[model samples]
Target: MSLRDMNCTFSPAALDAPDVASLLAELDGWAISGARLERRFALRDYHETIAFVNALAWMTHQQDHHPDLLVTYNSCTVSYCTHSAGGSLTNNDFICAAKADALYAQRAGA
Candidate 1:
């Protein structure tokens, strides 16, 4: 199944570099920053940015996996890392990343 279809669970195991790389291939625009999976979405304006944030928030809230959000006038950078998995990248991070991509794509008409 695609990561977007996967839900966050009690994952105590962290992913290694090789595994992270392979999973990254399944996602778009996300990259490893330290121990987190991050991606920045550029929107049209502040209104659009906040609207996107709200939409993303709703989706992530359903998954029960929240990401660190850095929002500006036209962009929002989302970073995800599972603290339950030793503060490193986990399958939860990748799953959320894929969902983020889908959300952004819908907003961007891609």
Candidate 2:
């Protein structure tokens, strides 16, 4: 399913690794780290890093699906999973990953 088709109220069935693998392929710079979908964004500097993080925060807030963010001087690592699914990966994770990719791409293109 497309990321736009996903909602915050995802069923807790937890997509299997194979299914998650397919979804991950469509998300740029994202990887499956055990049961979590993870990605690291390397920005030009701390300012860019924070801008990316704030953009991501706004997106997550709108979606009501937040990821764990690890911020540094010039990078941020985002990790996502469904706590409702016993900490398993779900479509919501991939959905947010896709949105995050688009946000980063747009920033880069600008």
Candidate 3:
């Protein structure tokens, strides 16, 4: 789906609200965690994972919104919470999440 389509799924104000556990469950298999748009992603190898993180960093910089990122030897985890909203989720979070997912898909295809 396009970014616009994804954007239509959430609103800036709505994202800051509490999360819905059931909605999050839908993305469980994609390695995303948490509710209300707070999610995590895990990669298989250090090289690939780091590359993905770098891409995410670049995207975050462009968006001017950041996520909590943790990197390990062969895995990376990302937590999305709008700091401006007091550690909650925002539309920006999901926008970044979708972009990251696209990046991950591109890497996997490569």
Per-candidate TM equals: 0.93, 0.89, 0.68
Per-candidate clashes, comma-separated: 0, 0, 1
RMSD of 3: 4.2
The sequence of per-residue lDDT tens digits that candidate 2 reaches over residues 10-96 is 465788878987887787788878778999998999988999999999999998889999999999999999888899998888888
Please, what is the whole-model Cα lDDT of each candidate in the order they appear?
0.89, 0.86, 0.62
lDDT of 3: 0.62
List ranges where model 3 is wrong by over 4 Å: 1-11, 14-38, 108-110
Q: Give me the overall lDDT of model 1.
A: 0.89
Candidate 3 lDDT, 43-63, residue by residue in tens: 777888888889888877877
Weakest ten-residue segment in model 3 by summed lDDT: 2-11
All predictions: root-mean-square deviation over Cα? 1.4, 1.8, 4.2
- lDDT (Cα, tens digit) per residue for candidate 1, span 23-98: 9999878888887888989899998899899999999999888999999999999999997777899888898889
